[model samples]
Every structure is written in structure tokens, then in C-alpha cells.
Target: MRHLAIDVGTHRFIARLEEEAAPRTCAAFLEMLPFSNQAIHSRWSGEAVWVPLGDFQTGLDYENHTSHPSRGDVLLHPGGLSETEILFAYGSSRFASKVGQLAGNHFLTVVEGADKLMDMGRTVLWKGAQWIRFTDLGER
Candidate 1:
């Protein structure tokens, strides 16, 4: 398990990458650590937040993807039909793109402070886009 820190506005969350389950995805994501982007409240995906993963693509590597994601499943969707993005599901969520129902590689999932998911969702929803940072915990 590779630990990561997700800081959104004032609220912070901790998650773990399922390296064993998604080796390629995890490795790619880890290499891009300490990236900050806009975390916006997803409209189509119920109770979720998302951020673009920059110009990175995994090209279907470790694409153990899924459309139905449980609460707190961090997914990495490689840009194919859509742009590469990270899905941070707080509650019931359906991973999708503008095209339609799409699956993503389940890379990370919240481990610590899971109880704060509801609050995190509420903050992003009401407060609009917030600064979000994804990084390896040990780095800083």
C-alpha cells in the first residue's frame, strides 16, 4: 500500500494506492506525485470529486477498470475516449466521461479519516472548485 495525501481546501484526506491490484496505474500515479489541480464537484457522478491528471496516460495499462465504484475508490481513467482524470468517490458514484458510462483503474482508496467524506463532499459542492494536491505521504 502506497500512502498518499489529498488536501482539498482546508480539509485533508489520506488514501492508499492498491499497488498490487493496479501495479501499472499505481506506478504511474506515484511518479506524478505532488500534483495540484482543481477539484470540482462532479455533476454526473453522484457524490464524488475529480481532478485532471495532467498530460499523463497509461494506455490501458492495468486497466482493471470499473464504472460502479464504491465510496472512496480513487480511480485513474486513462485518456482514450476522454481526458485523463482522477476520480475521488466519496459516496455512491458512477465513474463516467462526457461520452457516457466509463470505467477507470481503481488505483487508490481512502484509508484514514474516512468519516470526513461527507463533509469533504459538502465543502467542494458549496464552495466551488478548490485546490487539491495529491502526493506521497512520506515526501512531506
Candidate 2:
């Protein structure tokens, strides 16, 4: 089984991929992969945006639920019901939101400690008959 983990934030996107074919080292894996240039807004006409996950500010305030916020930037996260869930929840939501539309492209996030979120971004893979897992980064 192959697994890709993404942690999304206001400034960047962090990604980690695990496959049976390659050895797993967080630093080594990140060093080899290039940043992905996938369009964030499909309908919007603009240059492609690249968001790496490790660039988030620790104490900055951002909103992740509202699409059109009246006063603040909306930050999306994958769903989790508890405080501990916040970490994976936010990352998962961002991955789910962007992955489908950005298919056939590559990208990265700027967050940290995102290796265990295998359930995130699983649905973004192409059609194939393999053991797949998906973390629905949706809030409902």
C-alpha cells in the first residue's frame, strides 16, 4: 500500500508519501520531491499557485469554515470531532479540497508533524483497483 499525507495551512501545504517500494524518511522524502504547481481556484483566471505546508505561522488567527468570510481569511481543515483531531482535521480538509481539481498536477504544504494522517488525500489518486483509503476533508 502507498500512502500520501498532506497538512494544509493558510500559507503552505505539507506533504509526505509512503510506499512499499521506497524507504520512509521524512526529511529524505521531502528533499527529493519538487513543489507542486496546481491551481487553487479552478474558475479564477490567474497564474498557478504553489502552497508548501511548512510555512504556517504558529500563532496567527485564521478561519477555516466559512467560504466567504466577512473579516478574516478562511482556513479549511479535514474533519475531526475533538481537539486532538484539529491537527489532522485541518490538513485533511485542505488536501481534499484541492486534490480533485488539481489532478495530474503536483503541490506541497508547509506544516509539520503530518506523517500519520494517511486517511487524508486518499481519494485524490487516479482510478485503479488497489487498496485505497480516503479521509473526507469535508465539514457538514
Candidate 3:
């Protein structure tokens, strides 16, 4: 399994890449490691935050798509018909967008710092969009 880190403020979360489950998505995502973006709290998906990936050409691998994602699961929605974004589940979560509740491509699963998931969510939720960075832990 591949590894990555999600860093927000003082919190650091290690994530396991779902290469076997979502190979294509994992490959594309790993290629863009050390990605920094805003972790915005979703108004639609309860207790979830999303990182918009903008128009990346990552092909769809919906094998891991799910509307309801477990807390601490990191997901990517390879936007085709809609915009692409990364979902981070804090509490109960359902990956959704303006269109409606849609499945998100499961890519990263928090392996460490699981307890900090809720705190990260609450930070982004109450304080507004937070700058979160994804780093390839493999380099370290």
C-alpha cells in the first residue's frame, strides 16, 4: 500500500492509498502529490470537507464510488459530468454536489491520526476553508 499525508494546521494525517481498489485514480492522484488546496466544508454532505481538484483529466474509476463514506475515508470524484473534488469524511458523510448525492472515488484511507479527523472537519467547517496539503510520504 502507498502512503500520503494530509496536513492541516497542527494536525497531520497519514493515509493509505487504495491502489488495488482504485488503481487509475490512485496513480493519477499520486502523480500530483504535495497538492495544496482549500478544504471546504460541504453544505450538502454532512460532516464532510472537499478539496476541489479543478479540471484534472483523471479518468473515471468508479469501482470505489460511494455516496456514504466512512469517517476518515479520503475520496476523489473524477468529475466528468460535474466538477471534480476530493472528499474527506469526518463524521457521517455522503459525497454529493450541486447536482445531487453522488458517489465519490475512494482513494485514500486514513491510517494514522484517525482521531484528528473530526477536529480537522470542525476546523474547516467553523473557520471556513482551510489550506490543506497532501504530501507523498514515500519521499520521506
Candidate 4:
């Protein structure tokens, strides 16, 4: 049994495995979206408001914006998952990256303010299990 913590930021995604005690970097995860150029916006039709892309009924509502087919029982798509799983995994990866970047930036900002403190070191620090390396489909 292993616990995995996925911290998503605006620029990158950080994955930390509780059992391994490591952190991994994933950049360009969001760019792999199938509809990257497609923007979802609120549209005013002749009579009604139209929501672009519509609402997703099934699967986890990732980032509260997109949805994909569920991948069995695993919420986090592990390696060797099904095709749907892979898709969701990549989606999750991208979301993670966005979140990581945002968090990392926030953390950096806070750390910068705490420069006078000696105990607080660098802006980025991973204190957990080992890191499990995984290839991002975005890069593929």
C-alpha cells in the first residue's frame, strides 16, 4: 500500500510517493489536451444561454471543467491502465502540473518573504516517500 500526493501548479506537476520518499517533475502536461485551442465560453443564443462543450455527466469532473471515462476503481491512473485510464491519467497529469505551478509560485513568494528565517531553506523541498518516475503522455 502506497500513498501518492499529487501537487499541481501553474507551470509543473509534482508527484510524491509516500512509500518511496521522492518527488517528480512533469512539465507541459496541459499542452497535451486534445482540444487545447478550443475555448469554452458562455454564449448567448437567440433565446437561451449556450455553454460551450456542455456538461459532462460521467467520470470524475477534473478541475471542475473537463471529464473523461472512468478507469476502473483507480482514481489515479497508474501505469498499464486502460486507454480511457490513460486519457484520464494524462488529464490528471495536466491538472496536476497547473496546480503545482500555482502552488510552487505561491510557496516561492511566501519563502521570499521569510528570507530572514534561518530554518526555512530553499523555495522547493520534498520531505516524503521515494519518487516514482513516470513518463508524461504530453511529451509523447
Candidate 5:
């Protein structure tokens, strides 16, 4: 299985890449390893933090997509109805954009630090945008 080490502000987490379910998305994402960006509380998606990737493209369409993701679910929005983005759900989430409801490719799922997701979300919500990074852990 493939794994990724995620750093959300002061918190850390390990997430499993859902390669089997989202092969193209995973491949495209892995190519962008060691990704870093600012994550802020989502204005449309509840209980989630997102890193906006304006006009970014994965060169792929949605795979294993979902608008409602459980806690710890990581989604990549294929730019179309809205700008591209990566969303991390710490609680209930209904993915959307200014246009309306949308779905994202569920490429990563947090396995470690699941309990801290809420705290991470809260920090981004109240303290403003937080620096987040995704480090490829390779397959293990």
C-alpha cells in the first residue's frame, strides 16, 4: 500500500493512498510529492479545511468521487465548476463551490492522527490559514 505523511500546522498524520480506487488521481498526485500550501477553513464545505489550487489540473477526471466525505477523508477537486483544490474533512462535509454542490476524488484517507483532525480543523478555522504539507512515504 502507498502512504503519505501529512503535516497540518502543528499536527501530523499518515494517510493511505487509495490507488486502487483512484489510480489516475493517485498517479498524478504522487508526481507532485512534497506538496506544500496554506489550508484554510472551507467556506462552502462544512467542517473541512482546503488548499485552493487555482486553475490547477491533474490531467484526469474524478475517480471514486464523493461530495459527502467522512472525517479524515482527503479529496481532490478537478477544476471545472470551481477552482481546483484539495480538501481535508475533519467532520461531516458536503463538498461544494460558489456555483453549487460538487464532488471530489477521494484519493487519500488519514489513518494516523484521526483523533486530532477536529483540532486541526478548528485551528485553521480560528487561527487562519495553516501551512500544510504532504510528503510521499513511498509504498510500504
Candidate 6:
């Protein structure tokens, strides 16, 4: 199982790669490690935050996709009906956009620091966009 260190705003978390369930998406995502972007509270997807990539290509289709994601489930939207983006579910979430409902590749799942998910969501929701970074936690 591969792990990733996610630091968003002032909060930190650890997530496990869902390689078995979403191999292609996981592989592509891993190739882009040490990634940083701005995350804003979702206007359509409830209790979640997203980093809109806007046409960023992953060269892959949906794998292990879902519209409803539990808290701490991280999804990658492979750009089609809507723009490419990363969804971080902090609580109940039904992934969607201005265009309508959509599903995304469930590539990562937070394993540690989940207790702070709601706080992270609230912070982004009230305080506005926050900087989010993803780092590969190699060989551990």
C-alpha cells in the first residue's frame, strides 16, 4: 500500500493510494506527486473542497468512480462534462458541478488525521481558498 502526505492550509493528513481499485488513476496521480494547488470549498458538492484543474489531462477514463464519497475520500475528475479537478470529501458529499452531477476516480483515501477533516472543511468554507499540497510518503 502506498501512502501520501497531504498538507492543506494548517492541517495535515495521510492517505492510502487506492491502487487496487483505481490502478490507472493511481499511477497517473503518483506521477504528479509533490503537487500543490489552491483548494476552495465546493459550491455544488456538499461538505467538500476542490482544486479545479481546468482541462488538465490525465489521459485516462474513470476507474472506481463515484458521485457519493465518504469523508476523506479523494477523487480525481478526468475532465469531460466538467473540468478536471480533485475532490476532497470532508463529510457527506455528492460530487457535482455547475454543469450537473458527475463521478470521479476514487484514487485516495485518508487513513490518518481524519478527525480534522471537518475542521479543514469548515476552514476552507469560511476562510476561503487554502493552499493544498500532496507529497509521496516513499517506502513507509
What TM-score would every model get versus the actual structure? 0.90, 0.17, 0.92, 0.15, 0.98, 0.98
Which regions of candidate 1 deviate over 4 angstroms?
53-56, 59-62, 138-140
Worst 10 residues of 3 by lDDT: 56-65
The models' CA-based lDDT, in order, is 0.82, 0.24, 0.84, 0.19, 0.94, 0.95
lDDT of 1: 0.82
Q: Candidate 3 regions off by >4 Å?
A: none
Return whichever of 1 and 4 wins on lDDT. 1
Candidate 4, TM-score vs. the true structure?
0.15
Using lDDT, give the best candidate's number: 6
- True-structure lDDT of candidate 2: 0.24
After superposing candidate 5 on the true structure, give the runs of residues whose Cα lies further than 4 Å from its correct spot. Answer: none
Residues 1-140 of candidate 1: C-alpha lDDT, one tens digit per residue: 45899888888888887877888888887777778899999878888998866667566553678888888788988877777888889899998767898788998888887898888889999989989898788522
lDDT measured at residue 101 in model 5 versus the true structure, 0 to 100:
96
lDDT tens digits by residue: candidate 6, 19-119? 99999998898899889999999999999999999988889898999999999999999999999999999999999999999999999999999999999
Ranking by lDDT: 6, 5, 3, 1, 2, 4
Give me the displacement of residue 72 in model 6, in angstroms.
Answer: 0.5
Which model is ahead, 4 or 6, in terms of lDDT? 6
Task: Give the per-residue lDDT digits (tens) of candidate 5, residues 1-140.
Answer: 98999999999999999999999999999999889999999999999999999998778787999999999999999888889999999999999988999899999999999999999999999999999999998887
Clashes of each: 0, 25, 0, 22, 0, 0
Model 2 poorest ten-residue lDDT run: 81-90
Clashing pairs in 1: none
lDDT of 5: 0.94
List of clashing residue pairs for candidate 6 = none
